[model samples]
Target: MIEIKRLKFSYGETPILNIDELLIPYGEDCLFLGNSGSGKTTLLHILAGLIKPMEGEVILAEENITNLKTHEMDDFRGRNIGLIFQKHHLVHALSVIENLLLAQYLGGLPKDLNRIYQALDDVNVLHRKKAKVYELSQGEAQRVSIARAMLNKPKIILADEPTSSLDDENCERVIELLQYQAEKYDATMVITTHDQRIKKRFENSITLR
Candidate 1:
């Protein structure tokens, strides 16, 4: 589970995020909807422990990570959270399997070839395991990203505008894959986006102004 209290973050003199209180229970999927500059991504970053809030408590599970040091935060995030981005940030020079292995390594997890293969297969990208990352199409690459996100068996999966550029079919595919896999792992799934097309897919939602 995750909880935020009186969260306030700013860039210079401008306040970018000011969440009062938010809680996400374990093993659930929640959509975060908002307009541009409404702090959706900022909130996701705080949840993932990527951005330290200027003042507030970001509690994951039962630990408050707001005061965790950079290195400690990195390790903690690697083990507890999976972050997926809209651009499908795969290493262009790495093979598909290598890309996944890299993610696991970064997360401080032991590599499991079988799990890797299974995740790739789930996304219908197993055949491309030996192919270079740059060789994949947008959808294919996004599938790989999903596979990598689940690689660490994280407690929470955080996605930022994942389906922003995807077509309807691919968008649905991505959403279903995240939801199903998160359920399988009992990981809370939180997706932050500006797209209204994704609103109807989930019942619980957090809307920011």
Candidate 2:
């Protein structure tokens, strides 16, 4: 459940996004396709309430996030949105489980060890939960990222360029994992990317020129 209207955003004098209206229903998986400089990431940030649009209304989960205060936006995002960045921003010094715990703490949620372990297990990373992030392979680290994102059972999951740098096998695996987790938690999944390999996989897509 996401809706945007009269969305316009700019960086200084240059316009970045100019979406008139968009809607995504609950439990749907949508792909945002665009080339470099096409503002795919900018649109994702706006949807996640990480940036404010110059003029627009971003209604997520029946609330207009564009009007929320800073702290209120942060709290709402923490509780309702799960973000997966392309870089997989895990703390290298912390163990996999520790990184997950930090996310829970930052989200103002109680630390549920059983939930954390179940998340890891869902991503097939429970075996590496005690290992430091730096010790994981690229795939393992990405799995851990997925686990962390789903730890809170968010209502929406946003992934940015998730399959950009992976081999075909890993790319497929990542998409499957994202869809699996989304279905498991009944969350809407939105993935933004320029990767053509994934274009045919999603029936619902928005292309930015």
Q: Write the per-residue lDDT of candidate 2 for residues 74-188, one digit (tens) a residue.
A: 9999888999988889998799999999989988899899999999999899999899988999999998999999999998899999999889999999999999988888888
Steric clash count of candidate 2:
0
lDDT of 2: 0.92
Off by over 4 Å in 2: none
lDDT of 2 at 19: 86
Tens-digit lDDT string for candidate 1 (1-209): 88889999998999998878888899988899999899999989888888889898988877799988999999988888888999999998899999999988888889889989998988899999999988899999999999998887889889999999999998898898999889989998899999889899999987888
| Stretches > 4 Å off in candidate 1 | none
Of candidate 2, the 10-residue stretch with the lowest lDDT total is 181-190
Worst 10 residues of 1 by lDDT: 58-67
Distance (Å) between predicted and true CA of 139, model 1? 0.4
Per-model clash counts, in order, read: 0, 0
Task: Estimate TM-scores for all models.
Answer: 0.96, 0.98
Candidate 2: TM-score?
0.98
